[model samples]
Target: MARESDEVRSGTLPQATGGRRIAWAAVPEAVTAGIERLLGARVVGAVSQPGGFSEGLAARVRLASGGGAFVKAASTLTAPAVAAFHRREIAISRRLPRTVPAPRLLDAYDDGDWVALIFEEIPGRLPAQPWRRDELERVLTAVTDMVRALTPSPVDGALLGGPRLGGWAALANSAGIESGVVKKLEALSPWAARHLDELAALEESAAPALAGQTLLHGDLYPFNILLTAQDVFVVDWPHAWVGAGHCDVVTLLASVSLSGMDPQPIAESHPLTHDLDPAQIDAVLATHSGFLLRIAASAGAEADRHLVDMMVALGLASLRWLRDRL
Candidate 1:
């Protein structure tokens, strides 16, 4: 018989942003209760992790069995979008293999207002250290292998899954830049305005090249990977989509490089970066910095402001590197 506990409760779902304090309403209380009952365990502890771009409640739930799980329920302010996003994630995850360095999708529940997903917690730590040569080589090789294994999937822009070839336009549109960032970027140089104009041109030019490609890890970064004892595992699939393979490569490299560390040696040694134009490489990083800043600015929280500033600085640094490239 289906457990009565399986039915999700309405009031228990948290408001958007979870209302500042750690609240129980964000996750569907029924789902939590059901998970514990179904797993033959208890939720010994739980903590809400913040900085989520989407409307979702992410919590680390520790079970009585000494195992833990990450549970989340997403509800975009718009109902249709919430359903679509969840569906996309589920569909794409079904295609991925367990051997690949990614989190396994455990369970999914679509309860109207919210869509909940649970995944077995992968143990390990995020790489806090700088982009060392060995780490860079390892990450590049892993991504190369991951990309090679993917088969061309059908196009579904809503789900963040599609061919890898459509990257540039998607990135240009979604990288999150706005007037505030544009103004700030302009401040970087008298030529900065001209440069942004050039970027606009680049976006237009790159659109044709970006269509009908392969899948990509839309948000690849060291922080997204869990460095375990055996190997590294990538997490955070909310941004996964189909795009040019090089888009993921650029995102990965720019993410590591903008950590305020020297990436020249690592870039030179790694085959992925070895053949690329140094200036072009720098421009990609700069463009991504703007992308990150736009996302951060949209958060509107004080904590988010501080984080955005740091990212803006990184973007500015990338701009400087690119200026030298030009």
Candidate 2:
């Protein structure tokens, strides 16, 4: 189902990166035994999946029963933040309607410190980098479908707004711009320094523009998406929120730009955004761009190198797209 362009075939694009991962064999015996008890089968084989910035366990496992499942596990002792995310995902996954395209959450286990989620094994691969036109179309169609299905926000207590959705105004304030973070951002792109105030003003309208009832995936990086012959599946829901449906599409198109594709045309014609006001789109883009730049700017020396790199790349891409729109 993958369609790679000549550049991707030649490996010219930066390879995807993630956090250090622990082998499934190294997982605590108690946790593994608990997972087996939940599955009603002994795990016979496990292959780790290394495509996200979580220092936890993500794997495809074969059971002695001859079936397979995707397993994600983390512990407070090792990856407390990731364990918290797992807890939230478990809550959100249980409420997801069957019509949604995410992998079905088969079961979950928690032992006060360790958390694990078991999902139905999906036979799919990450979408090609520097996306092929046809494949991008399919993925866009899938986003539209998912948006339609998630309208009115089925999950209760989901966030209406968060750091990812807003903050440009605060970030543009005098103290903020003078801080090391904004300085770091300005170093990455001089354009950001020149138009900080204008971008902040544009973002003032973002809150009203983004208010909606659709549940957004919030993070739709290519690595979080999987493609099979028949379907596109969005994984990783820790950042999911209830907001404008077009939000996810905007975030995704920004990533497309990061992968070296011009996302303007795709954004112009994509169903989720085609009819929206250009200014509204600009507001959302500003909000997102500010968010990414802030993260990139504030990333600590001990932060995951890959995660920081992606944040900076995608931040620049979103800012570039916003600049073009203006």
Candidate 3:
């Protein structure tokens, strides 16, 4: 039964910016055939989902049995990190408990070169942009629910992240930022321009701010979440991390700012923030700001222009949050 949740305004999020998706026809025939055999049905039609950033293929497939399932696949040849995440998703999805509102894993295929995972396709819509207040509230509340249910992550927390989730300390000493990007970062706001160095140092000091036992979606932007009549579903687990209780909260609130929403109050009102310290929260936000700013400045590094554009928006948003509180 579809759970009837609060109703929210409908709108579209920014289109994903990345390389062309690898078509189903492009998948090695043996790989698709192997997946068909596992499902006990042949695939008749397929539609690629448009919201994710990885170079893998994520789509809903119509099976010969007249049903559907979600299939996600990647190869090291395309992007090694994506392939790694696909393998990690297989391991993580298999162990997820019922408490987490994520799609269920049905079958998996990996032959050293390519990895594919079949999931219970969720017929849910992406949350609207210029976000509706009610819709945003549900997602925030859902984060608390997900965190409460996953405090002692079902999987080992130690294997999650350090370099991946909170690698701000490394950024302070790094140097690939181009000149024009730095100028834009400096022009974001008067407060940001005046206090850039301070924010970076605080981010460095809070290097371990992401520490905790909760399994985090780590990247909790709009595209990674889905809203059904009954539940909120989070997808794309390759970036999942073991982090602070409110880590996902920080990411979620920062993202909506791109649509011109004020992030400060939204961050404060959440139940998850009740026990967290203010300084640590700012520290973590600063770290995210640094990461985004740095990524936006990468001139020639291979990146999705759309993702870079969103990063620029999010970096400014995170910085604004810092300016207001710091």
Query: Distance from true position, residue 213, model 3, in Å?
Result: 1.7
Best by lDDT: 2
- Model 3, runs deviating above 4 Å: 1-13, 163-194, 299-301
The lDDT-based order of candidates, best leading, equals 2, 3, 1
lDDT of 1 by residue, 1-326 (tens): 11222111111111112233233354557756765664468888877754333444567788888988876666544445545666677776766776567878887766556666777776666554455666666677887777766536343556564322212233334352443444443443334444454554443455433433566676665556666666777766656766545556765654444555544555566655567655446545544644544443344544434345444444444444444344
Tens digit of per-residue lDDT, candidate 3, span 102-160: 89999999889898999998999888877888999888888889998888888765445
RMSD (Cα, Å) for all candidates, in order, is: 12.0, 5.5, 7.1
Better of 1 and 3 by lDDT: 3
Give per-residue CA lDDT, model 2, range 189-209, as digits (tens).
667766677778877867877
TM-scores, each model vs. reference: 0.71, 0.91, 0.88
- Candidate 1 deviant stretches above 4 angstroms: 1-28, 35-40, 49-55, 77-87, 151-158, 161-181, 187-191, 208-212, 276-290, 293-303, 310-314, 317-321
Where is the poorest 10-residue window by lDDT in model 2?
A: 1-10
- Error in Å for residue 183 of model 2: 2.1
Estimate candidate 1's alpha-carbon lDDT, on a 0 to 1 scale.
0.54
Error of 2 at 164 (Å): 1.7
